[model samples]
Target: MKFLQIAAIAAALSALTFGCQKKAEKKASYPPTPATLVKAEGKSVRKYIDTLGTISSLHSVNIVPQVSGQIVKINFEQGQFVKEGDVLAEIDPRPYAAAVMQAEGNLRQAEAQLKIDALDVERNRKLAKDNYVDKQTFDSLLAKVEVDKGVVETCKAALETARINLDWCKIKSPISGKVGLYNINSGNVVAAGTSVITTIEQLDRLYVDFVVPSQRLYDVKRFMEANGGKAAVDVSYIEDDLGHRKTVAEVDIILNKIRYESGTAVLRGRLDNKDGLFWPNQPVKVRVNLEEIKGAVLIPNMCIQIGPKEPFVYIAAPYKDGVYVISQRDVGEGQLFDGGMRAVSGVKDGEMVVKSVSSLRLQAGPFVYAATPEGLIMGADSKPILDPAKMREFMSNATAIADELRAKFAKEAAEAAAKKQAPVEALKAAEKAAAGE
Candidate 1:
């Protein structure tokens, strides 16, 4: 009886092992996943350092009055584009004008008195030479003429100063730019050199200011030193109604010192804003081109997948009948460039990579079919689908296949769960029966 029981247990174990093997075999067989594939190309990829930056006018200034007086007239409309030397506002010139008139009258009076003194000195010298006048009297007359000459010079200087003050009443724009709103309106008194009248920013040319890690300072310096003291850069920003726009610029200068708190150095690029696309103090995206990688494998950024250990891409090798064998390859450091592409290592030129696999449960060593974004099966060579009827038919079939696979996978999962619970249910039933006995 004991030998028979031992043999029965051994036979049961063997059968269980066989059943597990069968399950494993069934799980290993998977349907071909549909995905879009793109061929990797070899090209020179420009490496860039991306960061947020701010737009600033090349020349910005705050307009102020040169003489203190009440504002009489505002010449410019708010937010109007103005040119250099354009009168922006006018101060009460009546006071300054009156002072100019007073200075002119004073200068005229001084000149007339100096002429009279010169005549008196000439007459007194003649009298002193002829001995008709006493020496004391002639000398006294000469001293009086000299005193009058000194007074005339003092009046001349005062008149010039008064004339200058009169010209300062008119406030003009110092640079060609758009004018900001008025700070002090007409009829308000503003102090000279202290009160701000308005602000202007030159929009024909702009400066893009951005910061990068201090470690990258050397790279930027190298690029500039090699390329005539200017490094290539691109500035991009979005408009509310116009979507996105980008413009090329060049780095003009790097700040002399780095910020200790952020460990970054500031770089300023010169950007042409003749179209007025960029504004002062506007935030923008900046890309500083450092260097180019030659003969690098380039692929669309969407093809990269973040795995548990590292970023990877699925390489697809042509198999039989429009199917491909998928193999996951771990890529090295990647640099993003324009047009949604990235330069990456570990992929070779002319190799096909899966562009998108988010909807598919994929693994290494599985077969996949190349499909378009619209789910139309592509040709074995991944050529463009030119036939409308064929695309429609394939799209319908692809949708049906996807739905069927999903249902089948769900059913299998349900069955596996049920199988796992069957033994527990059986054991519970047996325990209840034994207790009842």
Candidate 2:
């Protein structure tokens, strides 16, 4: 019986110890953690889809000689811009000029023969009417006149062809564009319709070709239809600043067919490059604004804390006792916005979120100290009113106060030391007087 009683006492002691430990742990409290905080605000957000594009010329021509001849004069420099019908090069026109003269002479001879035949036909008709010529002979004379008239018409066509060939000796630009390197220089014999003189590319108005995912085709079409059947896009070189947004022409056919390999479709945009900033086959960036979201709740990207389940942020609020506390609030993250911010759904507008904390350790209802742009504003509905000038003013005033305090403390320490030393010296002098006595 005594052994059983001792066992019961031991069990009681063990339970008591466990209870005390639990109480001590429960009573422990963490100090207020210092955290950098940002405010969630509502604003107009523009959604944009970005992709790489290539600049291409709408018109690219490989200039070829229309007539075979030796180049007598190279009228244009390599890489010079020329307008349509501008003379680019001059082939040896002397031969073509001589050919034109010869054709003209042939035409004149045919016309003179036709005139003589007509006069003979008139005389033959009179002879036949007067019975001075047989009917068969008159018919033969009329046939000769008709044949001569046919010869004259053929000669006129030949003369026109000769003139056209002569004009082609002066090679002209087929389109207004910048010319590439000369393939055939002066004194080089070019084959008609075969040898390439040079290449011309129209750069004033350029085409930019890009690809968009097949998923976005519907949105692109819908947006375009709502906005005058034209999807406004912008194209800029990779090195250009994104501040200025330029407009791009809508493609007549938007992604005519989907690419099976990449699940993308080709989109072509036209840009007017009056400044000659764009070039053919040049790599560029394209931006297409799809839609706008009004009253978007945005927060800094760094504020979101990812967990095993979902992403969340620390909501810093204050208790009725004037002590600020932080609670973890789960958030549904949306697409990223400008300025490294993200659109979030859980947090309301004007809500304070912990952007950065001194320690990564976080818990529910933990005490927190909030730092903000607006002179250390604290609590739940508080937002950091960002004013650079105000922040500078606050820093200057704080620095001045610190310097004054430091100087006052130094002076007080010096006075205290002097007082202590005088008492010690006076005591030593009194002891010396007693020794003398």
Candidate 3:
């Protein structure tokens, strides 16, 4: 009976060992986690200083008349584009024309009188030589001739002034620009240099005025010195219906003095406004490119993860059978650009970065399959499974897979706890047995 019992005990122990080995093999067969990755690119990244800006015309003029008169006719439509010397409005020219005529008549009279006085002086000079005329009378005639010549010059000046005033009656544009509404319309008299006739803003080129902290002035100067004495700028604005628009502008001027109250220096950039997309006094965003970092590692903004100490990114290395091993890397972040890209260091060019992971507790050395941002698992060819039927099948079983993984993790945790308690439990049992003895 003892031999039979020993054989049965040996068989039971062997079966239990086999069952434990099989369970271990099954647990190891779980599929790799899915991860989405983006390839880091090598490119030039520009460092910029961002600030708010205002769009202003390079030339804005408040049109005021040089001569006062009644406005007879408005020659330009409201908001019309006018060239320099284009007739904008016509004042009543009747009075001005009459003044010119009167001045001409007076000038003609002065010339006639001067001619008579000169003839008299010539005839008297001959008489004085022959003693046919008195010496005092001849001298007086010559004096009259000189006085008449002075009167002619004065009348000529008056005529020129009258002509100029007449020309001013027709108000004309002094610059090529768009005209604003007429302030003083037809039949209304406007004071010279006092009443604003209209406004004109030159829209061919615009100025983007912005301010930067005074501390950044040195940086701007450095960039300018390196880049042909001018730094590049980007001006952007958003419209109500249309989306954002941006254009490259040239930095033209920096104010000589900084604002004491704001501790900022004013800067201006020139933008081409031929498209008429920008307007005076319009607010916009300005980005001043202070410097450029060549051959910088560029990655998507989403790839960066904030850690307790610093920012980090997950790098993926190709392992076996289309699986990747993930590793964390601390990185120094640089400038952020449009289109959700950022400049970073400590990442090699052309390396794959894990953008996201399926499991929350994913750590280093975990095998992961490449997946699309849409969660579709990639095939052995490293392409996403785009077939609708296959995608549906994978999605349908995703919940089951997740549940299985959760159960497996829970079971492993419980086994580890049990292992830790096993030694303590045995020690307690031995102590209890000793006490009983």
Off by over 4 Å in 3: 1-32, 45-52, 112-149, 212-216, 231-236, 240-248, 259-264, 285-292, 363-367, 385-437
Can you write out model 3's per-residue Cα lDDT over 1-437, one digit (the tens) per residue?
22223323433344445567855554322455678888999998778898889999999999888888888888888999999999888878888899999999999999999999999887778789999998998889989999999999999999999999999988888899999997888889888899898999999999999999999899998888888889888788845344367787899688999999999999998999888888999988888987778998889999998988989987887755456656678999987887888999999999999888854435211446679878778876668888999766655554344334334444554566579899999999999999995
| Tens-place lDDT digits, model 1, residues 1-437 | 22223323433444455567855553222355778899999988777898889999899899989899999999999999999888899888888888888888887888898899889889778778999999998888888788878888888888888888887787888889999988999999999899998889899999999999999899889988989999988898844354367788889799999999999999998988888788889998888988778899989998998889879888888755566656678997577776788888999999999997544355321446788887667875567567999766655654444334434444554566579999999999999999995
Better structure of 2 and 3 per lDDT: 3
| Candidate 2 or 1, higher lDDT | 1
Candidate whose lDDT is highest: 3
Model 3: ten consecutive residues of lowest lDDT: 1-10
Candidate 3: C-alpha RMSD to true structure equals 10.5
Output the worst ten-in-a-row residue range by lDDT, candidate 1: 1-10
Per-prediction TM-score, please?
Answer: 0.69, 0.72, 0.71
Ranking, TM-score, top scorer first: 2, 3, 1
Against the hidden true structure, what lDDT does model 2 obtain?
0.75
Model 1 spans with C-alpha error above 4 angstroms: 1-36, 116-150, 239-243, 302-314, 319-330, 354-378, 383-437
Each prediction's whole-model lDDT (CA): 0.79, 0.75, 0.80
Residue pairs that clash (backbone atoms under 3 angstroms), model 1: none
Residue 214 alpha-carbon offset, candidate 3, angstroms: 4.4
lDDT of 2 by residue, 1-437 (tens): 22223323433344345567855563222334456877798888977777888888999999898999999998999989999999998888888899899999999999999899889888788789999999999999889889998999998998999999999999999899999997988999999999999999999998888888899888888887887777777776676575353546555457679999999988887778888777899888788777888998999999998878989887876433224456678899987866889999999999878888754433211445565543363433455425777545534543343233333333454455579799999999999999995
